[model samples]
Each structure stands twice: as C-alpha cells, then as structure tokens.
Target chain A: MISFFNVSKVYPNGVKALQGVSLQIEKGEFVFIVGPSGAGKSTLIKLIFREELPTKGQIYINGRSILRMKRRDVPYLRRQIGMVFQDFRLLPDRTVYENVAFAMQVVGAKRSEIKKRVPEVLKMVGLEKRMDDYPLQLSGGEQQRTAIARALVNNPSTIIADEPTGNLDINTSWEIMECFQEINDKGTTIIIATHAKEIVDSMRQRVIGLERGKIVRDEHRGVYANATT
Target chain B: MSTGVYMQMLLLRQAYYIFQEVGRSLIRNSLLNFAAVGTTAISLFVLGVGVLLVINTNEIAKTIESDIEIMVYMRHNLAEEDALTLEPLIDNISGVQETTFISRDEALKSLVKQFGDEVEESVGEENPLPDTIKVKISDPREVNKIAAEIEDLPGVESVRYGGQDFVKKLFSLTNWVRIIGLLLITLLGFCGIFLIATTTRLTIFARRREINIMKYVGATDWFVRWPFLLEGIILGFFGALLAVGVLYFSYGALIAKIQETISFLPLVNSSAVLFRIFEGLLAIGIVMGAVGSTFSVRRYLRV
Candidate 1:
C-alpha cells in the first residue's frame, strides 16, 4: 500500500514541483500517474524511493512514514519497490541475465535464488533468448523489457515504471504494457507514470492526473482526463 | 536452507561479482590502471629506499661511536707503581669497557708501521708517541665526559680523545639525511595519492552510465560502491608487487656491493629489510586504492 498525505515538494531553486497532492492506492492494484513534462510525476515517484523528501506532508509505504527515515534505511525501502526508467537503465557491460541478477545481488539474494529467479523473470519479460546479450545489443523494447525483468527479480511489492515505454514503438509499447499486465495479474502492485494517451485509454485502470504540480483528476477507470477536461 | 546461510551465500556471490566487475574494468582500462600502479610503485620504491638508508645510517653511526676509545697520555716523569695503580682506577670508570696499557715503545712501533720506514727510523731512538692508557668506552658518546674526568687524574699528562666537534658534525649529517628521507617520502606519498585518485576518477567517469543504471535499479550505496573499492585494491596490490620486486632486486645488488666495498657503513641485511618493506608496501597499496576509489565515487553517487 502507498499513501501520500498533502505532500508537496519545493526544490531549493524556488521551483514548487508538487503541491498539496494527496492520494492512496491499495495493495495489488495497478495505477497510472498521467502528466505532462514538469507536471511533478517524477517527483511523486522519487518520493516513494526517498530520492527526494516532500517539503510538506507525510508519505507512508505500508503504514511506515518514509519522510523521516534515516539515509541508510532508504535502501531497505528501495528493496521493496522496483523502479524502471525511460532509458531502461541497464548496465551497458552486463548481459541481460547479469542486469536482472544485479537487482537480486544488491538485495543479497542467494546464488541459487538469483540463478533460479533471474531466468524465470527474464522468461516472463520474454528476454530469455537474449539473456546473454548486453543492453547495447538489445532493441529499445527489449532493453525496456529487460529493465522490467530486472525490477521484478527481487519480487518487490510495488513496481514503479517511470515512462517505461517512452522510446518503444506503439506495438512494442503495448507488448511492454502486456508484460506489466501479466505481472499485475500475478498480484504485484504496479504504478506507471507516462505521457502516453493510448496507454492510459487502453489500461482502464485507476488514474491520477497532475497538471502544473497539482492533482487534477483521480478516477477508478480514468482516461488521460486532464487532456480532455 | 536456513535464511542466514542463504543470505551469506548471496552476499558472497555479490561481492565476488563486484570483484569480477572490478577486475574486468581494471583490465579494460589497463592503460590508466597501469599508470596508477606505475606511479605508485615508483613513489613507494623511492620512499622505501630512503627510509632504509636513514635507518642504516643511524645504526652504523651508533656502532662506530660505541666502539671508540680514549687515550690518556702519561707524564714522562711519573712513577711506574703510580701509573700501574692508576690503570685499575681508570678501568673502573662507569662506561669504560676495557683499559689496555700501551707502553711508549709499542706505541712507537705502531706509529712507525703506519707512517712508513722513514718516520719509523726518525723516531726510533726517541719515542714521539706517548706511553698511553687506551680506554675503550662501552658507549662512544661517553668518551668526552670520561676524557674530561681522566684529565684531572694524577699521573696523566693529557687526554687525546676526540671532542664534541666531530660528534656535532656526525649528528648534523645524520639529521640532514633523516630530513631529506622524510621529505622525499612525504612528497612521494602525495604524488601517489594524486595519481591513483585521478586514475580512479577517470575510470568511474567512463563508467558513469553503468553507475547511473545501478543507482536507479534500487542498488544500495554499498552495492554500487564495492566494485570500485575492489578495483582500487587490485590496482594498489599490483603496483605494490611490482615495486617490491624492483626494489628488492636493486637493493640486493647495491647493498651487497656497497657492503663489500665499505664494510663500515653497516648496511642492514637486504633480505631481512626487504620483508619489512614488502609488508609496508602491501598496506600502503591497499589503503591507497580503497581510499582513492571511495573518495572519487562519493562525489558522483550524490543524487
């Protein structure tokens, strides 16, 4: 479960990125955070991982306030939430298998667990064939899928995909979404931040839309509502 | 398997992977790594040799000073019984190791042998060298004090032990050698740190993409950190090994030849001193690598 109570972020440069935004998502739910560039979508996701602290209001991940968490404790919180970036964020030198295993390795998963889980997750993301291939060798879609596989290796409670398919073609982007759908069906909570209208319309999930650092819409089955509003 | 056992296996595997990554990175960036190592080895080699010289110089000086003896020249008209009685008194002095009475005749013969046949014949009838009591001090530094005490004794004409001027000059020389050695070591240490830091910084810079990926993927600070630290350790160890090898062989040859030519220098046994230096080099290299990597990575890990 994730909850943000009246959260606001004001960066030191006098930019108030997110203001008085409050929202909650139940466990095992898939949600979309839709916003334009500089609309505070990234800032909200960053808060979940303690990358940036909200200047106002408290953030609770499973009832634990992370706003006051110690610096060292940030890693433990991160271990429970897997994150994927728009760039795929895979180590260039590592093979697909290594990239996925790296997440488990950071959490100190056993060698047997890693060996067992890495291939399983890679197969789930349809990257089993490219397990030996490096990120540079993989296509944008394949790299993003690998990134998704890496995020799931630790079996995190929540998966946060920040523009996970930003660089993929329409079909490949849907395929990446289907992988998320399949992952979601398996009871892992999924939260995605994206600007893709087709993605929001097709997913028919609870959507939280932000405009200029304020939440403009929250719907059980939203449709990039701010653009239409 | 137990949770603890499983956790340990995972940590070890992660550490191994990190070490492997570090090794591959070092090899991939071999040119820079080699530069790091080469600079460190040269600096350590110079530092080790300088320290070795200072240590040995002090040792040899102490040995020489402690072995010195004072000669007390007797009055020409002194009675033999009184001279003989004074011998035991002089021998009983606190730092006096032994006292040998050299008769005027024997002293003349030694002088003759040293100055050659011409001088020997010239002083044959009249003994130019005085009948002296040669007092070997247990500690050479006490020679002047003992000489001063002997000068006031009955039946003693003069005390001919070397004075403070020679000791002052020797001490001054020793001090300068130590200062120079220390200065060189300090300078070399600074240069070594800078070289290793720059090499590590460049390596990390080149791999910034990978580091960024790791950070985004929920990798802990330690998870991202271990590989760089291990890389530094490997570089340091390799450099130290090369330096030790070069220094050991060079010191062995030079010390052997120098000891043979100038036996009085008391050059420390190279084989023995080499082991100590080797240990120090190992410590320095590892610490340098770890510290340098830690320093360079912390800046970019922020944010």
Candidate 2:
C-alpha cells in the first residue's frame, strides 16, 4: 500500500515538480499514471522509492512514513519495492542470469536461494532460454524482460515502472504489458507511469491523470482522457 | 543444520563472492588495474630505496665515527718511559676502548716512509714527531669528550681527534640525508595514493552504469564497495611484492659491487636489513592501495 499526504516537491532551481499531490494506492491494485512530459509522474514514482524526498509533506509505504526513514534504512526500504526505468538499465556486459542473480546477491541472499530463484524469475519473464545471453545480444523486448526479471527476483511487493513501454513497438509494448498484468494478477501492486494513450485506454485499469504538477483526474476503469499524445 | 554452521557458511559464501567480484573486475578493467599496480610498485620502490639509503648512511656514519681515534701527544721533552705512563690515564677515560703507545721514533719512521728519505734526512738526528697514545673509544659520539679529558692528563701536551667542526658537519650531513629521505618517502607515498585513487575513480566511472543498476536493485553501499576495495588492495599487494623482489636482487648486486670495489666502506650487510624493508614496503603498499580505493569510491557510494 502507498499513500501520499499533501506531498509537494520543488527543485533547487525553483521548478515545482509536484504540488500538494495526495493519493492512496491499495495493495494488489494495477494502476496507470497517465501524463504528458513535465507532468510530475516521474517525480511521483521517484518518491515511492525514496529516490527524492517529498519537499513539504509525508509519504508512506505499507503504513511506514518513508519521509522520516533513516538514510541507512533506505536500501532496506528499496528492497520492498522494485523499480524499472524506461531505458532498461541492465548491465550490458552481464548475462541475463547474472543481472537477475545480482538483485538477490545485493540483498545477501544465500547462494542456494540465488541459484534457485534467478532461473525461476527468468522463466517467469519467459527468458529462461536466453538467460545466458548478454544484454547486448538480446532484443529490446528481451532486454526489458530481463529488467522485469531482475525486478521480480527480489520478490518485491510493489513494482514502480516509469515508462516501461517507452522504447518498445506497440506489439512488444503489449507483450510487456501482458507480463505486468500477469505479475499484478499474482497480487503484486503495480504502478506504471506512461504517456502511451492506446495502452491506457485498452487496459481499462485504475488511472490517475496529471498535468502541470497537479493531479486533475483519478478514475476506476479509466481511459486516457486527454488525447494530445 | 545448526544456526552457527549456517552463519559460517553464509560468511564463507560472502567472502567467496567478494573475491570473485574483485577478480572479475580486475580482469574486466585489466589496463587500468595494470596501471594502478605499476604506479604503486614504482612509488613503493622509490620509498624502499630511500629507506635503504638512510639505513646504509646511518651504518656508514657509525663505522666512520667508530674508526675515529684520539691522538694524545706527549710533552715535547717527555721521555719514552714517561710517555708510556700516560697510556694508563688515557685508557682509564670513561669511553676509552683501548690505547696504543706510538713512540716518537716509530711516528718519524712512518712519516719518512710517506715522504721518502729526503724528509728523513731533513729531520736528520732530530725527530720532531711526538710520542703519542692512540686512544680508541667505544662510542664515536664521545670522541670530543674523551679528547678533552685526555688533553688534561699529565705529560700530555695536546689531544687531537677528528676536528670538532668536521665531526659536527658529518653528523649534520647524515641527519639531513635522513630528514630529506623521510620527506621524499612521505611525498611519494601521497603521490602513490593519488595515482591509485585516480585510477580507481576512472575505473568506477567507467562502470557507473552498472553501479547505478546495482543501486536501483537495492544493493547496499558496502555491498557495492567491497569489490573495488578488494581490487585496490590486490593491486597494492602485487605492486609492493614485485618491487620488493626487484629491490632484493638489485640491492644485493649493488652491495656486492660496493664491497668488491671499495672494500673499506662499511656498507650495511644486505641480509640483516633487506628483509625488514621488504616487510615494511608490503605493509605500505597494501595500506595505500586500500586507502586509495576507499577514498576514490566514496563519492560514487552515495546510492
């Protein structure tokens, strides 16, 4: 579960990225954050991971006030929520298996656990056959799947994906969305921030729309209301 | 399994991973690792050479100082029997090791051997060289003190040891060499640290993307740091070991040559001192390497 209470963020250069944004996301909810460029969507996602603290108000994850969390505890907090970037940030030199295994390794998971879990997660992402291939050898969709597998390897309760389909073709994007839908069906809360209008309208999920640093809409089974692309 | 056994296994696995990561990164960035190792070895070698020079200089100074002898000249009219009586007085001085009485005739004979028979003929029947007691002291530092004491002895006219100004200059020279060597070692130590730090920084910068990915996946700061720290330490260890190897053989050859060419110069025997220097160099190398990596990786570890 995630909650934001009157959260606001202002950059040092005086740009307001988010303004008094308050919302609650329930457990196991698959949600879409629909917004255009410069709409504070990225900042919202960053706040969930404690990448950037709320400038004026409190944010909580699973009833814990992350704003007051100690610096040393931030990593442990991150372990509870997986993150995926638009760029598919996999280490190019590392194979898909190593990249996924690294997630478990970081948490000091036992070698036996890592050995058991990494392949299982790769299979879940449907990349089991390509697990030994380097990221450079994988297609864009496969690379993104590898990233997804890495995110899932830690068994995080929530996945915050910023523009998960930003770099993929429509067909590939849908495949990736199908993976997210499957992951959410298994009760992992999913919050995806994207500008893909067709996918949002087709998915028919809970949608929150933002424009100019403020949320203007929140709807159940929502469509992409503003179609400016 | 028992909890204690499980914990031990976990620690062992963690150590294995750390070492594996260190080796992987070293090979991945082989050029940079090589550069760091080379720089560390050269810096440690310079430091080792400075240490050897200071040690040898101190040894030479001690040898030279110990070789100094005080010549206690008998009164011009004093008989040989009476001059020999002054020997006991010279020998009784606190620092005196031994005393040898050189009769005036013997001194004249040695002078004539040096200046040929013309000097002997010039002196003719009158031998002007004084009957002197050559006094060796246990400590060269006490040479001036012993000389002063011997000067006051009965039937002794004057005592001449190494000139006071010359002795002072020699000590000051050795002290300066030691101070300068120490300063140079400190300076080169920092230079080595900086070089290793810079190389590590560059290596980390090249892998910044991998580090960023690690952070996103919840890698702790220390987890990310272990490999780099280990890499730095390895570089330092190998660098220092190589330098020690080179210094061992080269210093041995140099000492051998010095002994053969200038046999009288009291060089420090290699076996007695080189091993200690090797140990010191190794410690310095490893410490510098680890410190350099720690310092360089600090900025990047903030995730």
User: lDDT score, residue A141, model 2?
Assistant: 91
User: Looking at model 2 chain B, which ten-residue stretch has the lowest summed lDDT?
Assistant: B267-276
**Interface Cα RMSD, each model:** 2.0, 1.6
Mind giving the per-residue lDDT tens digits that candidate 1 earns over B117-197?
898766667666667898988866667888889888988999887676887677788889889988988887777777778
CA-based DockQ, model 1:
0.55
The stretch of ten residues in a row with the least summed lDDT in candidate 1 chain A is: A220-229
Evaluated on the second chain alone, the candidates' TM-scores are 0.86, 0.86
What is each candidate's DockQ, to 2 decimals?
A: 0.55, 0.57
TM-score of each: 0.87, 0.87
The runs of at least 3 residues in candidate 1 whose Cα sits more than 4 Å from the true structure, single-residue gaps closed, are A12-14, A110-112, A225-229, B67-69, B87-100, B115-128, B135-146, B300-303
Off by over 4 Å in 2: A12-14, A226-229, B1-4, B77-155
* TM-score of predicted chain B, candidate 2: 0.86
lDDT of 2 by residue, A5-44 (tens): 9999998889999999999999999999988899999999
Query: lDDT, candidate 2, residue A171?
Result: 92
Cα RMSD to the true fold for all candidates: 3.3, 3.6
> In terms of TM-score, how similar is model 2 to the real structure?
0.87
Docking class for candidate 1: medium
